[model samples]
Target: MDLLSDSALMLKVKSGDNHTLGLLYERYKKRLFGFFFQMCKDASLCEDLVQNVFIRVLKYKHTYTEESNFLSWIFKIARNVYYDHFKAAAKNKASDVDELYDLKSSDNVEKEMEQNEKMMLLKKAISKLPDDKKEIILLSKIKGLKHKEIGEVINCSEGNARTRVHRALNDLKDIYLTLEKR
Candidate 1:
């Protein structure tokens, strides 16, 4: 078989080729986990969310159309999974976004410490953003999704996705600068 694109694999999955789901999983597991980790900042929860997304894919497989973009479809499911998880849980117990920060490897201890501090500030800034802005930033900057794909995932027009992303980056910069002063 030729190297199948994500959409192709999903099409196979929709056609009852269950093994294709494994191929899709292998390709996207890390990306999906990273996406979830950025939001929840809990490894175990992110793992569960990833599983939920795939399970959703399976449960909703019949809804998949050949024209649908698989990545956008899966991410929509992920967004729903996140929403459901948060909705069911108490707010006080939500994952602490700060805990997601990790220090970069550096021979100089000072530089490593500085980098870690910066990362924490950035994560905190990102965490402070409103949910819509945060999701746009994650989908655009972190996941490298195009405006069209983001639009599909978020159910907005391409123009709206671009505008939201621009606004989100501006908001994030402002928040980050404010945090830096503290």
Candidate 2:
């Protein structure tokens, strides 16, 4: 029901109410996809990763606990899935033509093109970052998780999470500038 909290819904899922997971899936599917999209350049692979996260949630449903934050729990599983895929695909980096995220449009065509170019450069810069920093940036910026939530995802204190986000942003900016210069 609409009033059921995510934890309650997940508890239902853990209790063998298999259909309840679909509700969780609906609630989180887009955010999950967005997370994967920023982490990965391949659209199809991103889709697969989203499916894998749910598959993991279902496979490991018995472990769900009432005290656990459902969003953090699911993201931990998703992070693992991403790491597994990342290791497996480390040697085969390839890019596709599809835009990773949507670009805002304005009335001025020249500005739009310039903005598109800048975004592409930024994506390239993001790709150059180490995996952990990249994940932090995506979680903080793209996913809009607060420092405390990010700490939960990365298993650190909130202050540490804030520092990591700050460091990651600085690193990203450096990479973006270097790429832009070339």
Candidate 3:
């Protein structure tokens, strides 16, 4: 079923339909897990967070409003889960070693090594940006989110999201130039 039709299924879920909820979980599991994996840079942690997000959704299903965008609401919950995990990790002084590895695998390790080098340079450039700009860039460019969707995720206006993405691209270009000079 299409995403719009999923709203009807969600309504069923709200009214205590276990089968509809299971279907919804099956539909979203992979995408939501991928989002968590990227954000956490840890497969195990991503799995845990994904479970927690769905658990929270099921527990609080009564609070979900028909006026809200379903995917956006789900993502917001995922985002909050990510932030909570980050806060807890920081408190515990945990290190994320998985962040150092590329998520993709290739047949040629040499070519992958070259790509990783470039990625490290790009990551350094991204690190130079202010948090807001970096977030917009990551969501828009890397995650392939629309400006409006990103605006919703970041709690900004669409125009603001567009402006920040534009500026972030310019900043990234400048950083690339600096790296080229070095």
Candidate 4:
């Protein structure tokens, strides 16, 4: 299959082309997995969430419009999937340990330890943010979505999205600093 834009791939998927959906999955699985893992801290549940996003895409293919940003649309579905899971899991009191992604081997164990410590603190700081701030930070910084795309995902105006991201980052910095001092 030729390399197509995400929208083109989804347009094909909209027309009942299952192969295109697989292509989309291959393109986005890691990103979706990372996003969910960061939010939920569970490898197995994040994997399930990634699969659920694809299932949702297939189920709601008809709702995708040519003008819609695929990143925003897909992430919005992912966000809903996560929130739905969170609600159910909350009712069940489910929680789990932090999921580790494959880390490149370092020649220096001390350096690796320091890096891991910083990462742990950052994750804790992110977790401390309000849900809206956390979602904005995840969408803007972690997922690399532009404010315009984030606005679509968050259902806000572009300017509002930009402001939200700025606030979230500032809040993150404050939280990280506070945690670093601990």
Report, for every candidate in turn, its global Cα lDDT versus the true structure.
0.85, 0.84, 0.71, 0.84
Question: Which candidate gets the maximum TM-score versus the true structure?
Answer: 1
Worst 10 residues of 3 by lDDT: 89-98
Task: List the candidate 4 regions with Cα displacement exceeding 4 Å.
Answer: 91-121, 142-144, 180-182
Per-candidate TM-score against the hidden true structure: 0.84, 0.82, 0.71, 0.80
lDDT for position 17 in model 3: 80
By TM-score, how accurate is candidate 3? 0.71
lDDT (10s digit) by residue, model 2, range 1-182: 48688899999999999899899999899889888877776779889999999999999998889888888888889999999987886564645423554566656788788888898888777767887998887788744478988888889999999999999999999999998898
Q: Which residue pairs overlap in candidate 4's backbone?
A: none
lDDT of 1: 0.85
**Higher-TM-score candidate among 3 and 4?**
4
Ranking by TM-score: 1, 2, 4, 3
RMSD of each: 2.8, 3.3, 4.5, 3.7
- Candidate 3 residue-wise lDDT at 165: 91
The deviation in Å at residue 182 for candidate 4 is 5.1
| Model 4, span 71-103: residue lDDT tens | 999999999998998787654322322444334
lDDT of 2 at 160: 100
